[model samples]
Target chain A: MENVLNWITANQQIIYIVVLMIFVGIEVIGRVPSVLHTPLMSGANAIHGVVIIGAIIVMGKAETDNYLALVLGFLAVILGTLNVVGGFVVTDRMLEMFKKKK
Target chain B: MELNLLTLCYLIASITFILGLKMLSNPATARKGNLVAAAGMTIAIAGTIFLYEQDGEKLHNYAWIFGGLAIGGIIGTLAARKVKMTAMPEMVSLFNGMGGACAALISLVEFNHLSKQLAANEVEISAVQPTVLIIVLGLLIGSVSFAGSMVAWGKLNGRVKDFSFTGQNILNLLILLVAIVAGVILVLNPGQPLLLYAILGLALIYGVMFVMPIGGADMPVVISLLNSFTGVAAACGGFLYDNKVMLTGGILVGAAGTLLTILMCKAMNRSLQNVLIGSFGGHKTAAVAGGKQQGAYKEISLSDAAMVMSYANKVMVVPGYGLAVAQAQHVCHELEKILEEKGVEVKYAIHPVAGRMPGHMNVLLAEADVSYDKLMEMEHANDEFKTCDVVLILGANDVVNPAAKNDPASPIYGMPILEVELAKTVIVNKRSMKPGYAGIENDLFFQPKTSMLFGDAKKVLQDLCAEVKTV
Candidate 1:
C-alpha cells in the first residue's frame, strides 16, 4: 500500500494530464451517436454498483485513528447494499407492473 | 514522467464507457453498446481497486462487508424472483430512491470530512472552492431526488393518493423559496449550524414539493425524471473527487435521464411546465358531467365473446392494468399459443405508458418468456389492428381510448392513443366498465363492434384460448 502511494505521488502530474485528455475524448465520442448512450450509461451505472465493493476496500484501509473513514466506510456499505438489492428488485418489479389485464 | 498504471486503467475504462454510449445510440447496435459499457464498468471497478491504497490506516476486516455483499446478493436475487409483473414501477422507484440517497449520503459524509479539515486548518479555505461547491450542490439535489422518488414509489404501490396536497402550487413555491434561502445562507456562512439545518430541512421539503403533486399515472415518468437527477448529482460528486469514471458515468446518466424525461413527457402529452410547475402532476379535479348523455350499457357473456374471437384469423391483444390486477400474463401467453395453433397470427399491442410504467406491457410479455418478436409497440401495430381478424383487449383502458383524439370534451383530449378503434372485431375483457385510473370512460368500449368479455383476464384469455383451439 505504501509503495502504491509513493508511486501515485511520483506520477501525480502525468496522471492528471492523461485523465484530462480521457475526459475530453469521452465527451467527443458521446456526441457522435445517441443510442450507444444507454449501453454505455448502464455500464457506468453498473460500475457505480462497485461503490459497495469500494466501500469494503475502504473499510479494509481503516485504522483506529481513522474513525471518520471507518464510519463512512460502513455507511457506504449499507447504501451500496441497498443499491444492489433495491435496484434489481425495482427493475424486476417495474417489468412485472405491465402484465395484461383480463 | 512516471504514470500510475491504475490511473491509466481508469482512463481506458472511461474510453470504453464513451464508446459503449456512442454505440447504444442506435437500436441495432444497442446490445453491443451495452456490452462495451459493461466492460467499461468492469474496468473502472478493477482500476479503482488497484489504485485504492491503504497507506495511512489498516483496511477494515472483510467480515461485515463481505457478509453484507453476500446477503445483498441473495436478497436481490430473491426479490427479483418474487416480483410480480405488476410491481415493476414501484420497484424501479425504490431503486431510483436508493441511487439518489447514495449520492446524498456520500456528499454529506464528504461535507463532514471537509469541515473537519477546515477546523484543523489542514487545508486552506480557498482550496475548498469548486470541489466543495459542487459537492454541496450534489448533496442538495440528491436529497431532493431521494425524497421525491420515495413518494413516487408510494404512489405506484397505491400507498398514496394520485392527487396532490391541497394548495399544492403555493406549497411548491414556498418550498422553493425556503430552499433558495437555505442555499444563500450556506454560501454566506458555510460553517453556520443554522445554515446546515436549513439546508437539510429545505432539501427534504423540495423533494416533497416536487413529487407530492404528481398523479399516479405519472409515477413512471416521475421515476424516470428522478433517475436523471441522480445521475447529475453523482456527476457533481465525481467532480468533487476528481474521478474520471464518476464524471463519465454522470454524463451518461445526464444524457439518458434527459431522453427519458422527454419521452415521459411525450407519453403523458405534457410539456415540462405541466409536470414541474403547473401542478400538472396531479389529477384533473374537474370532470364534465355528460349532462345525462351517458351511453346505454351493453354487457356480453364471456363465453359469447370468446366464441367470436375463437375463429379469428389475425388477432391483436391489448393488455392493460386489468390484466395486471388479474395476474393474467400467463393466460394471455397461453391464449396466444392456442391462437397460433389454430392458424391465427397473434400479436400484442404495447402502449408506451401501458399499465403502470413505460414498456409495462412489454415487460409483462417478456416475463412469460413470450417470443421477443411477438410484441409490437404502438406505432408499429396500430395499423395492423385494421387488418387484424380479431383484437382481444385484455383488461386495458385509457391507452386504447379513442376519445383522446376525437372527443375534445374528453379529459384525455389531444393525448396520443393506441388506434385499437380501427380494428374490425374488437373483444374487450373487463371485470367491469368503470372509468380508468385517469377517471375517463373509454369510447372504444361503446363502439358498435366492440364486445366486453366479463371475467378475470387470466381466466378469460385462457378459456378463450382453450375454446379457440377446439374450433
Candidate 2:
C-alpha cells in the first residue's frame, strides 16, 4: 500500500493528465454524428499509431545481443507503422467519398 | 534543450489530435481535420527519431527502424488504396488488429527487458510492481483485441462462420477469469515468464470465443467494442513509456469507440450485455422456432414497380448490405435520377445500422455521387415516410420490418424501423425470401401494401432504371 501511494505521489502529474484527457475525450467525441462514425473511428485508429514512438524507443535502447527484445521491438514498429499509415489513408479515402456535391 | 524540443513536438501532436477530432464532428471540416492530425503525427514521429535520448545516449538501430517503417508504410498505403468500399469494415478490423498486435508486442518486449534487469539485480521486483501490472494488462487487452478483431475480419469477409455450443458463454467467462487470474499472478511474481505466455494464450482463446457466437447483424457494436479495447491497450503502452501523445490519442479513441458502441446498441435497442452474450442472429432456431407463420407475399413486375415509382409524387429509397454486395449503388443512383427527372421527389432513408457498419449506407451513397442533401437519417425519413407515395427498399430487410415494432417475442422487437408501411405503396428488392443478415423473418414482407420484387440488387436497379426511363 505504501509502495502504491509512493508511486501515485511520484506520478501525480501523469494521473492528472490521464483523468483530464479522459473527460476531454468524452466531451469532444460525444458530439460526432453517426454519419462520421466509421471515418472518425479510422482517424482515432491512426492516432493510436503513436505507439510507434514507444516501439522506436525500445528498439533503439535494446542491447545488440538481446535478440528477443530486438525482434519484438521490430515487429512492434512494423505493426504500429501499419496502424498509423493505413488508418490515415483509409480514413482519407472514406472522407473523400463524402465530397460535397457540386 | 533536446528534451524541451521533443516536448514541444508532443504538445503540437496532442493539440492537433484534439482539433482533428473536434472538426470531425462536422462534414465541412472533416477532411481537413484528418489532414491536420496527420501533419501533427508526422511532426511527433520526426521529433522522436531525431531528438529522443535515453540516459544521455542517443538512439541507434536506424537501419531496423527505417526499414520496418518503410515496409509497413508501403503495405498499408497500397492495401488502403486497393480495398473495395464494401470490404471497408473488414479492412478496418484488420488494421485495428495490427495496432493491437503492436501493443501486445510492446508489452512482451518490455517484459523481457524487465526480466533481464532482474537477472542483473538492478531493479527490485517490489519497485517494479506497477510496471508489471501495466505490462500484464497491456498483454491481456491487446491479445484479446487482436484475436477478436481477426475473427471479426474473417466474419465480415465471409471467411469464418458463427460457431457456438451450449454453455459457450459460460466457458468464455471461465476462460476470461483464468486469464485475469494468471495476469494477477504474473504481476505478483515477475519471474515466471511462462505465466505471461499462458495469459497471452488464454486471452487469445477468450477473444475468439467472445466473438464467435455474435450474429453478423451485431458486428458494428462488436467492432466498436474491440476498437475501444485496442485503444485502452495502447493507452497502457503510453502509461508504461510516459508518452503523453500516445496517452491522449489512445484515450480519445477509447472514449470515441465506447460512445459509438453505446450508440449502436441504442440504435438497435439492445443492451451491450445482450449483444455480447445473446446470439440473436447466429442461429435460425430463435427466429424460426418461435416466429409466427408469414402469409404469402405478392411479387411485383419490374415495369409495374417502375411505373409506381416514376408516377409517385415522392419516392423514398432504403438501401442495405445486399446493395453493396451487388455493387449497385451507382445504378441505384441512376434510378433515383430517373425518378427525379419525371418530376418526382427522390430521397434516401438511411437507418443508423442499415449496413455492415454504422453510417455504412451513407458511405455507399456518397461513393455513388449521390447528393448529401438527399439522404435522410432515420427520424427525418420516418417523418417523411408518412407523406411518401412509394418506399422502394433495395437489398434491405430488417430495418423496415414491422415485427421490430409490433412483435414483442421477436429478438429485434424494440428496434426502431423505418415505418415504410406508412407509404402508399412499398416495393422490396431482394434475391429471395431468405432472412436478412439477422436470420429473422420480416413480417413486413407479407403486408398487403408491400410487394416483393425479387432479383439481384444491381440487376433490379438497372432494370428499374430502364423501365423508369420509358415511363
Candidate 3:
C-alpha cells in the first residue's frame, strides 16, 4: 500500500494528465452527431494505436541475445503497427464516404 | 535536450489528437481532422526513432522494426480499402481486435523484462509492485478486448452463432472473478510467468463467453464497450511507459468509447448492465415469442406500391440491416430520386440503433449520395411521420416494430421505435415473414394500414424505381 502511494505520488503529473484528458474526451465526443458515430469510433480506434511507440521502445531496448524479449517485441511491433496503420487508414476511408455528401 | 525534443513531439501529437477528435464532430472538417492526427502520429514516430535514447544508448534492431511496420501497413491498408461497405462493422471489430492484441503483447513483453530484472536483483519487488499491477491489468483487459472483438467480428459476419446455456452469466462472472484473483496474486508475487499466462487464458475465455450470448441487434453496444476496453488497456501501457501522447490518446479513446456505449444503450432504452447480462435477443426469447400469432398481412403489387409513393406529398424511407444485406442502398436512392421527380418530397428516417452499428444506415445512404439534410433522426422523423403520406420501410423490422411501444411482454419492450404507424400508409419490403435480427415478431406488419411487399430489397427497389418512373 505504501509503495502504491509512493508510485502515485511519483507519477502525479501523469495522473493529472489522464484525468484532464478524460474530461476533454467526454466534452468533445458528446457533441458528435449520430451520423458520425461510426467514423468517430473508427477515428478513436486509430488514436489508441499510439501504443506502437511502446512497441518500438521495447524492441529497441531489448538485447539481441534475449530471444524471448526479441521475439515478443517483434510480434508487438507487428500488431501495434497493424493497429496504427490499419486504424487510421480504415478511419480515413469511412470518413471519405462522409465527405462527398457536401 | 534530445529527451525534451521527443517530449515536445509527444505534446504536439497529443494536441493534434484532441484537435482531430474535436473536428470529427463536424462533417466538413472530419476528414481533415483525421489527416492532421495521422500527420502528428508520424511526427511522434519519427521523433521517437531518432531522438529517444535510454542510458545514452539509442534504439537498435531497425531491420526488424521497419519490416514489421511495412508488412502490417500493407495488410491493413489493403484490407481497409478492399472491404465492402456492408462489411464495415466487422472490419472495425477486426481492426480493433488487433489493437487489443498489440496491447496485450506489450504487457507480456514488459512483464518478461520485469521478471528478468527481478532475477538479476536489479529491481526490488516492493518498488515494482505498482508496475506489476498495471501490467496485469493491461494483460487482462487487452486479452478480453481482443478475444471478445474477434467473437463479435465473427458474429457480425454470421460465422458465429449466439450461444448461451443456463447459468451462463453466472459462469461468466465466475471466470472473470478467477481472472482478477489470479491477476492480484501475480501482482503480489511479481515473477510468476505461469500465473500470468493463466490469467491471460482465463481472460480470453471470459471475453469469448462474454460476447457469445449477445444477439446481433446488440452488437453496437458490445463493440463500443470492447473498444473502450482496448483503450483502457492501451492507457495501461502508457502508464507503464509514462508516454504522454499514448496516455492522452488512450484516455481519449477510452472516454469516447465509454460515452458511445452509454449512448447506444440509451438509444435502445437499455442499461449497460442489462446489455451485458440479459442477452436480450438470444434464442431463448425467440422460442418463447414464437408461439404468438401474427394476423394475416396484405400484399402490395410493385405497380400499386409505386403509384402510392408517387402520389404522396411526403415519403419517408426507413432502412435497416436487410437493405445492407441485399446491397440495395443505391437502388433505394434511385427510387427516392424517381419519387422526388414526380413532385413528391423524399426523406429518410434513421433509427439510432438501425443496422449493425450506430449511424450505419446513414453511412450507406451517404455512399449512395443521399443528401445529409434529407436524412432525419428518429425524433424528427417521428414528427414528420404525422404528415407523411407513405412510409416505405426497406428491410427494417424491429426499429419500426409497434411491439417496442405496445407489447409489454416483448423482449424489446420499452425500446423506442420509429412510429411509422403514424403515417397514412406503410409499405414493407421483405423477402419473407422472417423475424428481424432481434428475432422478435413485429406487430406492425399485421396492421390494417400496413402492406407487405415481399421480395429481395434490391430487386424490389429496382422494380419500384422503374415503376415510379412510369407513374
List DockQ, one per candidate, in order: 0.18, 0.76, 0.74
Worst 10 residues of 2 chain B by lDDT: B282-291
Q: Rank the candidates by DockQ, best first.
A: 2, 3, 1
Q: For candidate 3, lDDT tens digit of each residue in B306-386?
A: 999999999999998889899999998898888877899999999987888878888888888899889899999999998
Give me candidate 2's TM-score against the actual structure: 0.96
Candidate 1 Cα misplacement greater than 4 A, ranges: A1-69, A81-102, B1-3, B22-32, B53-74, B277-286, B289-292, B466-471
The predicted structure with the larger DockQ, 2 or 3, is 2
Q: Pick the candidate with the highest DockQ.
A: 2
What are the candidates' interface root-mean-square deviations? 6.1, 1.2, 1.4
Which is superior by lDDT, 1 or 3?
3
Highest TM-score among the candidates is held by which one?
Answer: 2
Supply candidate 3's per-residue lDDT for B314.
Answer: 96
Give the range where candidate 1 chain B is weakest over 10 consecutive residues by summed lDDT. B281-290
Ranking of candidates on lDDT, top first:
3, 2, 1
Off by over 4 Å in 2: B282-291
After superposition, candidate 3 runs with Cα above 4 Å error? A1-4, A100-102, B282-293
